[model samples]
Target: MNIQNIEPKYEILLDTICKTYETGKIKAFNAVNTELVQTYWEIGKYIVEFEQNGAKKAEYGKALLEQLSRDLSIKYGKGFSRSNLFQIRAFYTKFPKIQTVSGKLSWSHIVELIKVSDDTEREFYEKQAVIENWSVRELKRQKDSGLFLRLGVGKDKKEVLTLAKSGQIIDKPKDILKNPYIFEFLKIPEPYHIAETQLESLLCDNLQSFLLELGRGFTFVGRQYKITLNNIHYKVDLVFYHRILRCFVLIDLKINEVRHQDIGQMNMYLGYFANEENIEGDNPPIGIILSKEKDELLVEYATYGMNSQLFVQQYQFYLPNKDELREEIESVLRGDNEIII
Candidate 1:
């Protein structure tokens, strides 16, 4: 009967009601999205079948789509633009088997996916999108950033196919590495002088976006994470725990090319984390020396036969150039060894 005492109980009741409502809403939305995508696929199939059967439609090509778009808009009222119709048609063409189209994705997601020209690249994006539960915008960003090409580069056809099927299996330290990890979302101007502290601050400020760029299962632990050895002070620029890998990821940033000393330091950090930071059931930590560049030969020698799971990779302030990325992928595929990592 007391108003003050009843407030907490009412709030709890409201919270439970809202939670139950949201669960039902999500299920309804997913069911609706699945139905819409199936309908679009059926429409696309009908158009294709008509095109095959009708001489006028077969001859006119896009003319048929234009007419269909106008007619469908008259009946449905909206969302039947010629461009969208063409997209729906392409979706069916790309995924001829309706079973292959994921019920998890909305029509908006499919619209972005059908634009990919390469089968392998498209499959990679599709599988990752579903597995990662990426939004349509996120899907577009990954496609534009050439994530598939980045992973596929420096590998043979078999490896590329495996990657497409597996969707970034992080079994080892190197599995999590991306050469020239993209931080364009940080909006740091190129050719501008910035200290490693500033870069680390920016990344921390944009941690959510950074985690997405870093790929799945990374949970940020801290920035400038400290690990003292024999009273000597040492700091890692960023520290993260990979849920899947079951290890701590220690990152050190360098504005310039990585040197032998950086490699040695990373090796030390890995040792300290493995021995001191890691508890039972935790794997040996991974150390990534993130820099603007790395001298491959020097790194190769510095890490020779020494096993501490240390890796050196570059970071770019901006997006990797598409033309250069394409050229590099092609070169690597053609047995060209010019671009090392």
Candidate 2:
């Protein structure tokens, strides 16, 4: 049978058959995964109800779980171990309302989510994971890096509460900003010194994790993205298109504190992108200066009159020092700044 002798119509038919098979396979896989998640959730619910006797009990719960674990392991094999049972029980307790549980997520995803004690924070992660189609590893990375906490910090109590109820909503350019963007996925040691180029390289190597940290709707465009004006050349460290916001996002990385010049250069980048690259359908571009530190007063004064959306944010190579970050957030919210004459 010569392949060249095959009719075009038959070739098209063959392609369609393959596509249909793949679609069916995916649907079957999803259905199986959904049922597995539901079964685990039901088991979790049963364990919780059995342990509840009247109120939450520590010692009684421990004994009950151990006994149940032993009995279930004997009958069902490995999945019903004491640790697994504890995870399941915690899962049911965390999501008391079964309706809130997502069948789209696997047991591994739920295991990661169950560790999040805050209802609001857990809800945010749950919604984001489904919306973003995060893998278990991505979900774990986000949680370990404190994505929710970083977004919640600096916000008022009410705003922070809102974050738990609804995942970060990007209504405006400012709404998309998170201070001290965590880059823990890069695996950079806390004490290590790395240049801007090295940072960009690490980020590109872990692009998926980087985008997830950046939040929803971010699609990478390019690195060292060029802009030319008056025969002078300038390059953005990284560029991304935000599908939701319908705008270009330009990022500049700095190993040290941000300065007035950094803000000015970013403002220029935004202007160039707005005038040169932005088409009729695109929103004005936004710029972010990601540095290790920022002078609050300098950033405030430098960006005061800018029409473009410009933000100076810090980036941590490792997980943030939570207490220090919290203190800084408090100071910013308090509007405390020192004047330098």
Candidate number of the best lDDT: 1
Off by over 4 Å in 2: 1-4, 54-57, 322-341
Question: Compared with the true structure, what per-residue lDDT tens digits does model 2 show for residues 1-341?
Answer: 96647675888878899999999998998899888777877988887777665457688888888899889889978888889888988877888777787778888898899888757678889987887788998888877777777887767756766776767778789878887698877878757688889988999999987887898879999999988989999999999999999999999999998888888899999989999999999999989999888889888888898864888898887787766655654454455643447
| Inter-residue clash pairs, candidate 1 | none
Top candidate by TM-score: 1
Task: Count clashing pairs, candidate 2.
Answer: 0
**Candidate 2, residue 115: how far the Cα is off, in Å:** 0.9
After the best TM-score superposition of candidate 1, give how far the Cα of residue 259 lies from its true spot, in angstroms: 1.1
Q: What's the TM-score of every candidate structure?
A: 0.92, 0.88
Model 1, 1-341: lDDT tens per residue? 77658686877787899999999999999999999999889988988888887776444768898888889899988999999888988988998998987788888899898988878778889899998999998898888778887777666756777888767777777777776688888887758589989989998899888998899889999988888888999998899999999999999999988888888888888888989999999999988888887889999999998764788888887778867776776665566764467
lDDT of 1: 0.84
